[model samples]
Target: MENLPKSIQVIFDKNPKLSELITNPRLISNSPFIFALSQKLNYSAKGNEDEYFYRIVFKEGSSRELMTINSGELRGLPTTTCIEKGKISDVAGLERVELDNESNLMPVLLGISLYSSIQNSLSYISNLCVDIRNHQILEGQARFERISETIVDIFNSIPDLALDKSLRDAYLSRIVKNNDDCYELYVSQREQLRHSLKGNNPDYNSKYYYENELYLFKDKLLTHPVFSVFERLVAGRICEIILSGNYSKSNIQRHKDFISKAESDINDIMASRISDLDRRISYYKRDIEMDRNLTRDGIEYHNTQIEKIELGISSIKKQIFNLLGVKLSSFDLLSQLMSKDEIDVFLIGGNLIVNDMQLTSDEML
Candidate 1:
């Protein structure tokens, strides 16, 4: 507490027991809160211009006693209350102090509660990663749901100190990176499962039955609000700089090149799929003709298969209709002149286009 703010020092003086708990070697070693605070203090001591402070408030007379933690700049007077009247009882087995209207112990209690939560979340995510690696799909999905909720709760308890570059890089960045790795692991497991099932079963219809389940699992985790926040914490600044036109000419050219390559890859994949579908349709037609003594039911099944294949081809053709040459070139040129919001709209529209192509591909499969 040597470089701690005077205001925090005053609070410590008023609450000696809380100070003792914070300085305890065991708690300090295991505490995320202490780790983050130490990082912030070290950075401030290095003569960084930004000053930070934390304020804790306890409210009485409610059905559930509430505690709030507000933190932000010591100057300019702007503060964000990360935990607003959160239920104190949410922390297990914590007894309230009657001294000084229970304010003396609230800060320590809050710290312990948040530390436990973060530890549990990190551990749970680690186990989920293991489950994913072992191909325990259902078990992994269940653990993910629990971890997702736990992470949101942990984030809500902590201050916006995560917004600080130093604090984010020290702590939250690990969680973000872990999430990215988990997603990749999930995709790899899904592919492995798909291949395993395909080899063991000849029914193509049931071969990909698990595909939607895998896709939904990935979608649910990535689209979680807390997960999105974590991603933004990791990459939002760079994205903002690029969108704000603060990037160099080379960066812009790189982006254009990336988009062009993506478009070309998509077109090539679509062309290949269309050719495969055409060959399948031709095979089914020949099967129906070559089996001259075939029953009416067999003929009907072959015709139905041909109709589905033709429909898939039609769907793909419609998607790739205006996307090949001129339209893509115009899109590349127009993106350069577009405003930030317009660029966002264009990117969103592009995702929708890609999603449509994905749907077409899934239907064909």
Candidate 2:
């Protein structure tokens, strides 16, 4: 309290509750005239912790009433706001003023209220993670349903934090990475299971049971809800950020570079996946042809396995298409010039047509 500026100390002296509630406050902004003060708070609920970020903007002189501005405006600003005296204020207005005797303290109070709201939203997400993990203990369709619900809950929570673009992007990137890691882990486990099953006797009942297990595992892996959800969330966020029209030329260029790199990475990953799927299909086809005593069901199982592998290859191809679409949509002119069908053909044949000229995917990206 003693380290605070005279003006700030005066405000706290006048409003005793300000010092009591604003825990771990740090002076984030200061000027010769002390126009604003920002603080980052650590808020916790139900044993889950989240950051509560807020700022306060002071009026030029004395005898000024409290005012509110949209959270979007708060970005790049020196100060943030909170509520005062148990009153809740809207955090969405561009600029709205309200008369109050303690106008100097109102901005700080508003900042606190905003932080509390953000913390609550984060706590809700933490709860959802816990719920999903518990549900994963269940088997089969029930587990898949629970996981889908949790992902939806996360998507819904995203809009609540839209005001803080950096925070929202960070949270989303973390989720995507975690889900990708989980998908890889699941695939590895399935492969290990497949190898183990191959060591079993090729009797009719045993062969049928092994095939059934592999089919179920492969179906679940290929159709995992997280895969499509990941594509939508990632691509949607990338497009939103690029199209927001808020960034400088240099920042926009940086985003473009990122999109290009992502396209390259996706292409590499898709190629590797397609190759692996093709190898598996070949192996299954060979098993059907070479096994002299293979029953009708055994032959049918191998054929089904080949079909599933082909479907997986198609899914990987679609993923690349989605990523390339995102990259193209980032450019207004390119997006307008190319239709989805044109993009699909471009991806399929590695060639794109624009204004009577054909361009390779590499050149386009």
Cα RMSD, each candidate: 19.1, 20.3
User: Which number leads on TM-score?
Assistant: 1
lDDT of 1 by residue, 1-365 (tens): 55444555565678788554555211212133333444444555686625434333324432333333345544444223222345234321232212111233233333233332223323332232333333324435554444344344334333322223343334445444444544443444434434433343222344342343233323432222222222222222222222222234555455445445534544553454345457766777897889788789988987887786676566546645433333333323323332222111001111100000011233222
Off by over 4 Å in 1: 1-136, 139-143, 146-163, 170-172, 203-280, 288-301, 312-365
Evaluate model 2: give its TM-score: 0.30
Query: What is the C-alpha lDDT profile of model 2 across 98-151, one tens digit per residue?
Result: 212223433333322222232322233334444444333222435344434544
Worst 10 residues of 2 by lDDT: 344-353
Judge candidate 1 against the unseen true structure and give its global Cα lDDT, from 0 to 1: 0.38
